[model samples]
Target: MTKKIEVLGSGCARCKQTTKVMEMAVKELGIDAVVEKVEDINEIVNRGVMATPAVAINGKIVFSGKIPSLEEAKALLSKS
Candidate 1:
């Protein structure tokens, strides 16, 4: 199965970095995932995340407001 991983932000540097970290973490863990970058402001707000550079896995909010650690990301990805 493929996990849906999304990085939500306004196309900022932090958002890009978050996506990069997520990609690297997934690659390191050998997990199958479909990653996407969401730059839509409305869509981001719908997630109830009051911060930039958030992450979502399987349509569920996993990390928000800051960059997440690889271990934390792995945990969220595993749930997918």
Candidate 2:
């Protein structure tokens, strides 16, 4: 099954880095998943995330406020 992964941020450096990390994790895991960037403030707030550079798997927030390591991203994706 393909997982819906979202990286939430306002296109800042950290956000981009998080997105990159997620991409690398996905590639390394060889898992079917789609990683999207959520840059809209309202959307991010609506999702109940006050911090930028957050991650959500299948509409559920998994990580927030900081960029996760490759292994962390892989673990998060694996759960979904």
Candidate 3:
């Protein structure tokens, strides 16, 4: 199954970096994943995230506020 990963933020550098990190993690792990950037503030807030650069996998948040490590992201993706 393809994992659905989303980076939620206001299209800031940190948000972009989060997406890139997730991409690299998936590539390195050879996992089938779909990564997306969500710049919608409403959506981000609705998810109970008070900070940018939050990561969601399969509709459940795995990380927020800070950039996650490759290993952390890969683990989240694996669950999806």
TM per candidate comes to 0.90, 0.96, 0.91
What is the per-residue lDDT of model 1 for residues 39-62, given as tens digits with 9 covering 90 to 100?
999999888879989998889887
Best by lDDT: 2
lDDT score of residue 19 within candidate 3:
94
Clashes of 1: 0
**Ten residues in a row with the worst lDDT in model 2?**
71-80
Per-candidate clashes, comma-separated: 0, 0, 0
How well does candidate 3 score on lDDT at residue 67?
A: 88
lDDT of each residue in 1-80, candidate 3, tens digit only: 78888899999888888899999999998987889999999989989999779999988888898988888888877766
lDDT of 2 by residue, 1-80 (tens): 78888999999999999999999999999989899999999999999998889999999999999999999998988877
**Candidate 3: regions farther than 4 A off:** none
